[model samples]
Target: MVNTISHIHCQNCSMAPLCLPKNLSEGDMARLDTIIQRHKPLHKKDLLVTADAPLRYLYAVRSGSLKSYTLDDHGVEQIIDFHLPGDLVGFDALATGRHRSFTQALETTMLCEIPLNSLDDLSAEMPVLRRELMSMMSSELYTSKQLLGSLNNRAADARLAHFLLGLSQRFADRGLSGKSFRLSMTRADIGNYIGLSVETISRILSRLQHENVLLVENKLVEILAMDRLERLAG
Candidate 1:
């Protein structure tokens, strides 16, 4: 059965600092809470939104991770981005009112959905939320640029190192351990995101492990030498 959660007050939400309600007044927090719809855990691989679907709400990852990807003309899946807890999804729909990619849970995930219309209406009364949304969108754009830069004329090892380092920093931002973490996405998904074949990704991981730079067993990654990884990323 699909699980659903009852709405909760924004002031009590752990994700408020990382979400649109960051720095909001108590009055604004209460107003923001009214528009949020909470969901129970979504099993891994369950789609939260699909490409071309009508856009109604923006989803915030309250827990776990998700991936956003799209299929090309030849039907090959191209991963666009991975969303961690506290990251916002569905902003790509803002321009066209339809999703441009599919967002799927990478693990059992919980989300808080913010109705777009209600958010806009509430934003007028709570300007801080509006500014927060803009800031979040800008941050997404910057991340996209970084992705593009990473994909351009870079070695496979460098790309992988960069990706790992990036993930580490993102986790640290969420108050999670940066040195040790599990990868929610598989090797193939990582390969797709980094523009490499699965075999190549495996080889790179093996090399890193041999060099004592990382400890990778299945999806779990322990960064044994972050300084070395950063230098390799450079």
Candidate 2:
């Protein structure tokens, strides 16, 4: 954990609507800045919140990404959710003091910590805050439902296709790209979530690359033949 967060990167990301930096604009966003606190920058594989850890603040992703997952009895990691820039990560701890899943940074990550009690007070004072909170919750529910639908109805290829598409959408939402993006999650993590093996993931990726559908280099995925990739995903 590096103390003194990188503020310049914060400026670059804040201007984009994807991250919660937009929370600074007007209404409650203004009030939010008053109580919000930035934590130490986390490098790859750093744990933000551990399962069963005490919940103190509402977390917002300033930059980078986070993945939350839990271990089964056999010690296999089951990914719960992946949080992108401007996304909230620790909502499940709102009512409970203990976290149900552990959240870890996927890259060099920055975070905004809002004391839950302070947010509660602000929500009481600002109707905009309350409404926005409700909307965020609703949106998350819809996303979960959609992911569940994919898991139930889509095949392995389609599921992976949809997963990549979903990532593109989230990236685009945060002012990133549908055609190019960085992959911080490992093939094993992706395989576990999509019910595939790591070797299978590698094979599929290579197959796609060989077909000129995309290019994968050092965790960067470039959509060379974007439509072709989408077709395979179908």
Candidate 3:
């Protein structure tokens, strides 16, 4: 049987609007609840969906973060995207009924797993839910397109600068220290996502630190000059 929850209030619940179908009424939410499954708590670095695993559930983060990646023909891991609290892990996988990439938790996480087969039924029955689902899919595509543009047109420094700001905004959404947050993604992951080498990523970060754009303390980044960081991002 699928696990179900009642309501989602961003201020109270761990998951926010990212996972929840926005503007869903009590009746709509109740219908979705019937097919929702609550997954087990995951620890940091715990693998959720490995490449080629049976794609069964579309997971929404109830708490914490997840990172999805895939290995190329050369066995080089390319970090695809980062999914923090309220982010959805896989929905496209349902099309093929197979996972094409790996998804692992960056921090201890709890997820709400919705059986893929049931999603269509819910969407068809609820107009608001259907629109919200389409919105999420559009947002994901937009993020991917943005990433491609950044890789093609932006310099490595600008890429890293923009990436940091994006992360800051994500952190702020979860009530975390947005500007002075710790990096959960590794340098290698960062390099892969930004289309740069680990050395290059390090160099750019070091340059930013020296430029007084931020104060670095291990994995933590404290922004010292917001305007300077914005200038670098551009």
Candidate 4:
């Protein structure tokens, strides 16, 4: 079920605050709206962008979630990142002009496609767009470093805790409930991202629930004790 809306304005987009046009002026936003093309809903496991494909547009996730991954020599998929609503994907191709990883929908997803060629002209006229793009790239780099550090951790519990805490903060940034949210990724996906086995991920979650630090019901998770979770993450 895809819903494509024509003539949508960034100034009125619910995700504007967390998107590229967060601080853009009204005039700039109108100009931006001209270049954005809203896509229909992508069903689960649909590829938004394929690895090695030529990059044409940057995608702003409007709703639902997506995952970026790459396959190893043995054909094992190495999950790299989870993109939530308000996250931008395809920036990795800015320098190379080709996507390095596959981006696939984790569930039903909607996005706004920003033509990359339009950005140069737009940025030249509106300096704020350039600065915002740079800021967003820097933030993405920082997140990559953080994920690298998390992957190096030997403790399974710590990695799991860190992952949950990270998601909580991200959800909070989107003006959503930080204490409770449904996880779009499955336990197997979580294990692959955090360098743990699926059984280990289940064990750690069970332990957290046993300690009353979290409450997990299927995919829905509620952090009952944020302070405890933070300590565990550390």
Candidate 5:
């Protein structure tokens, strides 16, 4: 069972800058808000959507995190990407009209739901919104490409460093502390996403901690040496 969160308009959302266009007029923003549906919080491991489901709405991560994944022919889960606040989901369904991967909550999460049909009609009247949506889709594509590049031909330790730094920057972009945060996903999920083994992930993390570059205790991580971590990532 799911429970709903309180209403918060787009104009008042702190993530508006990251999730919405900067130039939207008051009227446009209000119109967009009207089309949004707020959902109850999702608990840890709850499936938000499953593969091949019809695409009814796109989701904006209001808080917490989610992981998108699909199973391989051998029945292995292939983790695609982990989404954070300000990130959008459901783009994977746009081309086929059905979801291509399973999306689930990594922890308790809040999301803003935007109906696709209503958004289509609204975007037709609001060029700004249309453009912003297109920009977001394009940005998603670019991030996917960057992830592929990061995974290719990179050493295991370098890959881990790069992944951590990427998360750090993403958190900072959301006006949160970049140097410390919780790892919403498990080590195995990180390994699967970055093309490393679970053991490799733990070993790399331990090595980093030993080097005083980061302090890791359970899921909590603190960057003790940002400069050194950046150098390692490079």
Candidate 6:
């Protein structure tokens, strides 16, 4: 459930540099902030957007994480992406005006909801805003392509290693420790996203731990050898 919360101005948000507000003039930033709405934190498993839902707001994750997935004909979930803080959600709906996948919080999450109509109007007057939005969308597309390539060509162990390395870079980009972080998605979810079985996921994790490449304590993973992990990922 979403509850209206006090606003946090774009100028004051730490994510400003990494999110939509990046490189915007003060006045433009202020205008952009007007359309962004804050909400009470979402608990684990709370759906942010459902497939085929009308496009309303594009969400900017402020904290925690979320997963976007789609169901096949058999209703099996095909996990697409895991959204961390500083990531944008809902771009998938822009072309059709309906969401293509279901996005749900993997843990407690906070978001800034940008009303689509207002953003469309505001972007007309702000070239910087428009450019930033395009850049984000392009980045999203590139990441998707990279994921597809990895799934097609990488081995199971390489896929898992690459996934962990990707997480490390994302966390580090958000000013967190690159060597250690919590995994919000369960092993099953990870396996689904990377095209592996739950048992395979467990086996690879245990193998990494045994090889002294990582220290795994339930959801907590500490990369003990980043260089070795990179080689494994390659």
Candidate closest to the true structure, highest TM-score:
4
lDDT of 6 at 74: 97
Q: Which stretches of candidate 1 lie over 4 Å from their true place?
A: 1-4
For candidate 5, the TM-score is: 0.95
Model 4, 40-147: lDDT tens per residue?
A: 779999999999999999999988999999998898999988999888999888889999999999999889999999977889889999999999999999998998
For 65-123, candidate 1 gives per-residue lDDT tens digits of 99999999998899999999889999999999999999999999988888999999988
Cα RMSD to native, each candidate? 1.7, 2.7, 3.1, 1.3, 1.8, 1.7
RMSD (Cα, Å) of candidate 4? 1.3
TM-score to true structure, per model: 0.96, 0.88, 0.89, 0.97, 0.95, 0.96
In candidate 5, position 224 carries an lDDT of: 100
Name the 10 consecutive residues with the lowest summed lDDT in model 3: 1-10
Candidate 2 structure, TM-score to reference: 0.88
Summing lDDT over every window of 10 consecutive residues in candidate 6, give the lowest-scoring window: 1-10
Clashes of each: 0, 3, 0, 0, 2, 0
Displacement of the residue 176 alpha carbon in candidate 5, Å: 0.4
Q: How far does residue 106 in candidate 6 sit from its true spot (Å)? A: 0.6
Worst 10 residues of 2 by lDDT: 1-10
Ranking by TM-score: 4, 6, 1, 5, 3, 2
The predicted structure with the larger TM-score, 3 or 5, is: 5
